[model samples]
Target: MSGQRDRGGYHRQRPPTPSSSAPNMSAADPSNVPDAASARSAVTDTSELVEARRAKLSAWRSQGIEPYGKRVEGLVGLAEARARFDAEVQAAYDEAVAAAKASSSSESVDDPRDRVRVAGRVMQHRDLGKLVFLSLRDHTGDLQATISKALVPADAFELAKRLDYGDIVVCEGPIGATRRGETCVWADRIELACKSLFPPPEKWHGLVDPEHRSRRRYLDLHVNPDSMRTFTARSRTISRIRRFMEDRGFLEVETPMMQPIAGGAAARPFTTHHNALDLELFMRVAPELYLKRLLVGGMPKVFEINRNFRNEGVDRSHNPEFTALEAYEAFGDSGTMMELTESLVHRLAVASAEDRRGEDRVRTGDEDGPILPFGDLDIDYRRPFDRITYEDLFERGAGFSCREIDRVRARAREIGIDEAKLDDWFVVNEVFEHDAEPCIDPARPTFVVDWPSAISPLTRAHADRPEIADRWDIFIGGMEVGPAYTELNDPDVQLERFEAQLRDGGDDEERTFRSLDRDFIDALRVGMPPAGGLGLGIDRLVMLLTDRASIRDVILFPLLRPASEAGVE
Candidate 1:
């Protein structure tokens, strides 16, 4: 890799001429350099473009150059390389080059620009006879690389001209700006990193279809900059959440994703069979029960952020498999968990606001707090989120008290709910979900508390109001973020609730999955302390924070039907 300084302050590699021994290095081979028309036709005729790339791949190998390169050190990101460009240094070099040219001197100008090595997928390529310009994209962002026929080796220059839109390549050059003021890497050396054989998406309209984006996330990440930013934010947010919990004296823990009985929440579970034990196991619908077991085993404050699988329908806010954050604090009630949830959510919202609008632009105070947009609504995550009792909300929305079972049933039937098949409390909940939940302002985070004890089997009933469980669910942007419950630690009461739940199973499908966790009851008998438990939907939280419309957008790979079944080509 011997080099000389170019007029533009770039360390130029000595150009090599093709010898008789290297027949594949022939720069005159038309198949080796894809023309503009062939590149543009890739979207319409993928087979031709793929065949062309295959030919180039073979040509590189025949020239004793591996298309898939080995590890090289000191590789800088595209964004960082672009940032390293010094306008003053470039201006000085340009002036010196102009002076030498005007004097008819053969001496080369001293090139002092910062040198860098960068690698990324080729997103855009333009061949202009002696100069080839390429836009390369990495996860950080995109930067342009300029290759001059006089600077780099003949083989490297030929490789640059033949590069296809998804092919990854490494470039070593001085960090400088093009004549048009576009920041770029003035490459004197280029090497193929990975040869992409498949044709890429249309240049102007890349990977726009939602189904395709979700199915092929790798392509989506490369083409869609917003998707990359969203996923990066999601990763950072999860890490911040873990740190927040740890700072609050909570220990992060892991729980089993498979359970003998899906006893956490009332959701259908995906079942699997173990070959050695010859027993059926169910994917955990929630980590609630297992987390509670930790409380029994003397882990005073513990939390888990992991996947939960439910055999359920998928929609804007629902995914069959999703991430969740579940935590429990010993001797704390629903109020304590509510405070924790509110604080954690508020902190995340403030951080998100700072990221969106610069830190100086974020406003403060009670009334003017950090506001985040979710679809048509602007949600405020200020402290002291609105609170309302479930009964009060039901009364406000249905125009009657939920205690009036007959009126509740009538409202349920009026709203197209099958009141005849549901229990009294269940009928109340149906009306509440359909009519009451929407009464809360979409722009404000609200907690609907004191749900009926019958509906909250694992929650402790309030001492004063035996029928009202000490449970609260937080809703933001018209979506239920999570729920907190004062846990039921009494073995006798828990057993009774479990039995009642089994007796009240509405369908055979529900009955098949619903079972008593006798071991949990036994753990309770071992003298577990009263605790507050909360479960937050991580995917939905990300959707709200990132302002994404659907859960599928935030999820890297959401479940979908096969291509044939989905009617996709």
Candidate 2:
């Protein structure tokens, strides 16, 4: 027989039967046990498994035990408990037990191993008549728990014998190694923490369908450890961002989600009606206007990490509602924001690389910086990212400058773009996106600055070159991560720009939501300081850092079609 260790001591032989005073509970009835045939069938049939679990639930109640137990205090995480295991103490205890057994003495040897209380969902269970082994899983990782019939009370032993795969339980015992050298918690006390009525997914093959994973995120998070780690990393990344901003004197603030005018960006907004004021409001597409309002209120530096809603098409890189980081710095230009963004992204990439390698492999001044894989490409986020003017890239790709309207029109038509209906600058941008953007090295982060003034309505034009706006966009991993702009704070220019956007031709749907924000113009009239503004897609950033191929994987609960529409039961 295998030796067992207890809090009081270690014993080579079977300990004395547990006393009757252990608990006022009856033994499990033999008649309640399922036959071999039925037990095998239950594994393949979820309904049968659920019925079998319900029978065990009733049996637990008959024994004067609550399957849904009360709160258990002093419980440590399974990972922490596993880390506290001491090999030297276990070896010493084993030596003493062997010494006592050789002399044929009945005295117990003092055990020196650490004891821990842990709670987790049972992922695997094996009943060996006298000993039961269970693999329990929590967010951190999985750990094994061994239950000895001779160590725990009769009722607790019986409960351990009948534990289902998904049942949550709390186990308390000393940490020790098995005779086979497997580290486990030799549980002396076990109690059911929660009775899982529904049958879980198959133990070996969990939920594999992508749609199902997103629809039932709880099960996805439970069965898939990678999903859990991705979200956990995302949370840590956001926290690090907050600390970084705070350290740089950027005050975090919250702004209105619903606004009378969605004037921040040129995107369709979700509309809602307020009964109290009988007013129509649009969900904010971006918090740029509000964050700028803070600057007008005398806040030197302000940032907001929050949700923005836009009524738009959904794709791998776009979601109707998404998280974004918007920051504004007073008395700064696009150059200032460019440096800040470069530093922030580089640091995040370095941290992510360290996490992947399980060590601090890269540092700020390291000659070979961190390189993370995104799909098939390895993105190198070294400092001083590649930079080029927008017109220069356009000329490189299209073989003509953006100022040459006839050539831009010719290239737009060659690319099947409707150049006749669109204006000259619009055609130029369309051609640029099609022919020029792809010319960039997808593996290297690059910033394209000096955008045309017509495309960036809310951006300040260059002092010498009024036709070019002082705006820049950073692209990485073939995706435009974000943009920074020298904000237009002059009230007259701001109002004129807003009117021009409204005058630009659009469908009726766009016309309905497009309206001027006189209040924002008034805020600019309050003598707001010239500032630089930035907008970053948090979901895309997480996707890049985590090496996730889709934006939905980063978002915990991405929008999905209804079950009826999606043909899912």
Candidate 3:
């Protein structure tokens, strides 16, 4: 189709046809449509239906009504308005009306059902001559508004009939059940709020294309209730976590995202230079070091729930930018952190069960309690999570004890790793990760404790087993949810660990961001109490609880490549 450029620079193809442009317009079957990669070409700026909607905007202006409405007052939520429908009141009014009709009386009883003013985007519209039936939707839910020609003014009826899909409108009326018993608003007045400029996705197959859904998330949230529900649950989950921490006497604090030294965890960092200061900065991979400094400053209990950035690959559980929960408790050990982690997670699981059950009592333990579904598995979150020593798990899964250096190295080499150049502990870890990790039952929440000190640079060494660190990593559904550690407080040992890490300069990329945080060492010298630290991946937890398979599904507006960058047509 030929096109003409609009004032905003978008081209108008042609005026949309009435037959082709009703609410819930039936488009070509999605099965017949091209795959998502090629489907990007099907939608463009210049389109007939788009131009038609723009014409409605012009027509609205000509009629002395602004298509983009001003602030409306006294508007109630659609859900709240629907709830105002009193069954007893409606029955009384209906009975009185029937009595008047049967007696042929001229008198009438005043309609007393609750009256409300509400606004929403028009999702469905059926114009049958003089009457209009519309389905309006707001964030709360959908409500039907019925406008009869005899009940409303001539101009208001005309406005209701002319309304299109996606248009925002305000309705004022009494809430009552219709003849069909569907709770609806019998409209006495209707006014335009905003006119939509583009048609919504077809109703039957709303926003089915994955690429399209990500690119146009606004549409995705509106058209797909599942996406809406997932995000809603995510918000509540974060809120619940904050409340849980606060009730336990944890002070929430914020730390610098751009740090001079990214001395948290050993992960690749995204680097940038500050133009004003002429100094380089790295996006923090973890909040570990800064939080430790707070501990030195004598903050007894502190926590931070915020975003962390890392130069990492994207997958079902990985995101370059993600939310995390880091908490530190002074005078507490790794055992303390383990208890805290278990209590927090179990409470959350119970809350998830309560949310799913509504008013019903949530069962616990085995099949009776709240068993939240994670993918194909129903994770049992009852108290006393399964626990096993790292060494024992490694031996069981690798068919040899982790202390057997020769066997561990041989097994690493058998798995095609260059074991001769790697350290004994590194080889053991490699084998453990490759074999032992998979042995944990995905259906149970398990804690793998007592890692080797060589691999746990920040954990305090066990009293009896100096070679092993006092640390534990929690796993659920084959994914590591979080890790807890009895933080090392000795300034000398901490400094020695830092120096050792520096000497063992990893590859070029690792060495670039790896540096000694002298300030943290100084803080340790100032004396930090024996403490326990915990870091939980908030995004991954949300994914599991929400039953979302991909991290991208739980995160609203997850990073995506631009169409041009993706090479999509």
Report how far residue 242 has shifted in candidate 1, in Å: 1.1
TM-score of each: 0.88, 0.89, 0.89
- Per-residue lDDT tens digits for candidate 3, residues 1-569, read 11212311221122234654333322333343343322333464344687788887888788887888889899999999999999999999999989999999999778988999999989889898977899998888899999999999887888898899999999999999888898889999889998988779887688888767777788888788788888998999999999999999999999999999987788889998999999999999999999999999989999999999989898889989999999999999899999998989888888877776642333444446667788788888877899999999998899889988998988898898888888888889999999899999888899999999999999999999899999999999889999999999999999999999888947877887788999999999999999999999999899877788889888888887744422211
Model 2: pairs clashing at backbone N, Cα or C within 3 Å: none
Error of 3 at 347 (Å): 1.3
lDDT of 3 at 523: 95
Q: Global lDDT of each model?
A: 0.86, 0.86, 0.85
- Give the per-residue lDDT of model 2 (tens digit) for 365-458: 3547688878888788887899999999999999988889998898888889988988788899999999899999988899999999989999
Q: What is candidate 2's CA lDDT for residue 219?
A: 88
Output candidate 1 Cα RMSD: 10.6
Error of 2 at 562 (Å): 2.5
Clashing pairs counted in every model: 0, 0, 3
Give the lDDT of residue 471 in candidate 3.
Answer: 98
